[model samples]
Target: MKFFKTMFALSFITALFIVGCAVQQPVQPIPDFSPTTFNSNDYVSALDNFLIILDASSSMDDRYNGNKKFVTAREIVKHLSQTLPELGQNAGLRSFGHSPKVSDKLTVLFYGMEEYTQKGLNEKSGLVSRAGGTSPMHTALTAAREDLKTFSGKTAVVIISDGQEAMGLKLPITLEAAQALKNQMGEDLCFYPIFVGDDEKGMHLMEEIANIGKCGFVTKADKLMTGSGMGQFVQDVFLTKKPMVQAPAPTPIVATPPAVEKAWVVGEAYFDFDKSIIKPAGFEFLDKVVDVLKSRPALFVKIQGHTDSIGTRKYNDALSLRRAKAVKTYLINKGIDKNRLSCEGFAFSKPVASNKTAEGRAMNRRVELYPVTK
Candidate 1:
């Protein structure tokens, strides 16, 4: 009777409540994009190294879209790692403002400056599982300087965060640290800050930090969630196309050999910090240069040495000269006529990229080879 009706009503309400509670917004899926497979003959590595700075601050604990921002950030990094082609680039991951579950420290270089591998990066990124601490971004940036201290060549710093600081009190200090890293690394470094969440302030802050490197760009996590977007971002930051060299078409058999275009010109050679000794990669490249010179006895080469904006002009001038001489000596040993090889040092002047970033500085610290036909 009435009691039975009451029980029925209560049961119906309970069932409705349970149903309502069970219904949840479906998690957004990570979209697919064509995966890039890098071919050494067709493409070259753009960045020699990269470091990812992830924000595990409390603000990232807040929900964004359908999930916690921290979860989204973690997935983004993992996806980015997968999307990145194995380019022999050095990679590292640093997480800041994470809870005890993630790490006891305020910041941790959880991954590497070691050779990049998708599985390694994804596993390390997953370990940063919780977010519950004050944002100490400045400390992370300052630490990044140490993380990349020994790495040479072009580097990219990827910051994935909601861009919120602890009460915004340390924002300026964080910016200063980023600037210091840029100044320390010079043209050899760039920043790619990926903003998570929809906070307008966070987006702006990320943009400013990216601007500090002068060469990087700011992106949103939503955009990067898609496969195509991630592919483009990874390619833009990590790769450059190899110059296309067209071979001559076959002709009728002739007694005389056909003249060939000068397709074997060497571009530039890089040096290690403060050292004129050729690096292993430099030796391989210079061996190619030796072949080109041997093929063209009528050609003379002008080797111009340059240095980054690190030391005094006088010291750099001497260093640059030494680097030039090192290259000249290599050519002579390979049996190229020393009389046909001329070299000069430009010190820290005539920069190809801004001396304010590590990658730029690396570019400046090089020897340009110009081949002239006698």
Candidate 2:
């Protein structure tokens, strides 16, 4: 009995010590909200051209939870590139603290000012590896200014950072560089700064950077972890359609002619990513299309299926065809004559929107209904 008690006491003490050690680790608090999807296409018109200025400083080595700050940042940027609307605009990726030994070195532009492609952006984003040395954020910003010297339209300068200035640096030059860039670009430039970790000073610094650009805004990485949050961010940035105020004078209404032109706008049936089966909402949409097709029996309907630019052309071609078949089957089940529904898979060949963007790709990945009048 005495031996058993002694062994139990020792085991209990060992367990307590182990538990204590585990408790000493820093705890990363979970965000208030989390949702699954944050597809970038939902917010289409954020910017025509932009650069993702990623911080690769030594500070990113710190752990937010179990994951490194730099790792989280890389993932965020990768996802951002994947989802961002690619409306055939120029975009690029630039990194700071990549070359620590070289002080005078400018920020490296791994991507482009060329037509933005999701795959290209992702490849560039992945180029950033381990973080080292001081944060040369201002220098990076200056280099970015130079990079955009040739760009004419409104540009988005997106900086992802922990907000730490260069090591042992006294006065920060971020605001100065930002102002310089703003002056050069005028109203045509916007700055969006995202905080990678919960650094109060860093958040403040980022907010200041955002303030420098009248058109830009500040955000936190955590805020966009969930799909809904990401959607909200995209909406605020892209879907920039302003609300209309009621005018004192009402607009005049025009009456329609009895004989309308054969020109019919058949709304698109959108497909979810890699999905051929129509959703409940899509089915409802098809109901209206069915009615239109039934009313105009003389009109032959063409169902063209298309895929986004993510997959190989051959694979996408097959996928696109499957989508068209799915739509055709759905329509046939809904009492539409098989002869009236002619389906064709255009794949990614004939894209209405640029495949470089999420929204553009979303627009492209659809079964478009066009009335064929021979």
Candidate 3:
């Protein structure tokens, strides 16, 4: 018995020596961030309230492209933190599959649902040192109900994940949780999922999750690999793109009198009663507007959305804005430059006709296009 014990001890000592000889590389320090070199402020955030849910499960430690997935994701998150346009949004950072187990209380809020800043996010992101535990993304989604319960206006939930939930993970619960969040937030909520690697199944699952929210879409993680790439992603997901305004096109027909001319207005476009839906005739006219815009490339146009006064001022304003956006979307679809088009919802505030009668109200519900001087 003593001889056998001695042999076993010798074997253990040899194994320990071998393990100690193996070198573990130190984690590389993240590159220093330059705000001026990477800032994107030309546009503003689209969301009034937003949250970033990062995946930190063990799977993230796996390799992707060349580096570890977790490191790549963390870098992307850091870049986004630095790149997000400040639009007075209440933003928070949450992580699931990070705790020892999946639990309601395990969903950790590192930053806040408070006013967002790049510095604050960078600090919060530093708290996540490594990836461990199983992914409980559903629990994280479910937790959003409480996190965004009080905030109002357009909300965005940006989810970054490799998209692979743990085996036997509660995926159905995730779908259900997403639906519940939608029901609670209504049209105010949007989901933008970012995939870290080429996992088709994981990507599809994320796509389905985004579809449940009914807004935003699935995007690849590598899109934020560089400063310019990161800037573009921030602009796409967060910033509200500004219209590309240029100097007004010079009139070829020089009149003898140098008098100011009124801006061109497309009066043929009309919206239905109490609705923002544009008519087929309106679509056709907008196509002509597109042709003119294409022809006069130097000019920017403003889309004025108006509504009948049948509804409250607040309701009318929103409806008119939707109508304006609808018109802008049509013009964009017809190959018109988005940067050259701007929209302003006037609601019942700007009425060309009387709102006391049906005929006048019908005329009031219309969108007008006006040329903008540079």
- For all predicted structures, in order, the TM-scores are 0.63, 0.55, 0.57
Report the Cα lDDT for residue 176, model 3.
89
Question: In model 2, where is the ten-residue run with the lowest total lDDT?
Answer: 249-258
Could you give the C-alpha RMSD of every candidate to the true structure, in order shown?
A: 10.9, 14.6, 14.2
- Error (Å) of candidate 1 at residue 10 is 9.0
Each prediction's whole-model lDDT (CA): 0.79, 0.71, 0.74
Clashing pairs in 2: 37-227, 40-83, 41-359, 46-238, 86-357
Candidate 2 per-residue lDDT, tens place, 1-374, comes to 99999999999999999999886666565443343343333323435577889888888888776667887788777667655555566788888885455233446787887888878998877777667767879888899877899876657888989998876764357889889999998887888898988888888999999988998898888777666766577556644431133112212112221122332222344666666776564665677667777887886777778877653344466789988888889989989889887878877788777866666766666776667765
Q: What is the lDDT of residue 149 in candidate 3?
A: 96
**Between the candidate structures 2 and 3, which one is better when assessed by TM-score?**
3
Which 10 residues in a row give candidate 1 its minimum summed lDDT?
249-258
Error of 3 at 42 (Å): 4.0
Deviation from native of the Cα of residue 342 in model 3, angstroms: 32
lDDT of 1 by residue, 1-374 (tens): 99999999999999998897787555665455455455645554577688999999899988788788898898889788777767577899999998888678989999997998888998998889899889988889999999999886678999999988888385688899999999999987899999998888888889999999999999889877877788778778877654353222222122222233332222334665566877555566677677777888998888888887654454577789988888899989989999999989988878877877666666667776777787
Candidate with top lDDT is 1
Tell me the spans in candidate 1 whose CA falls farther than 4 Å from its real position.
Answer: 1-34, 168-170, 246-374
Sort the predicted structures by TM-score, highest score first: 1, 3, 2
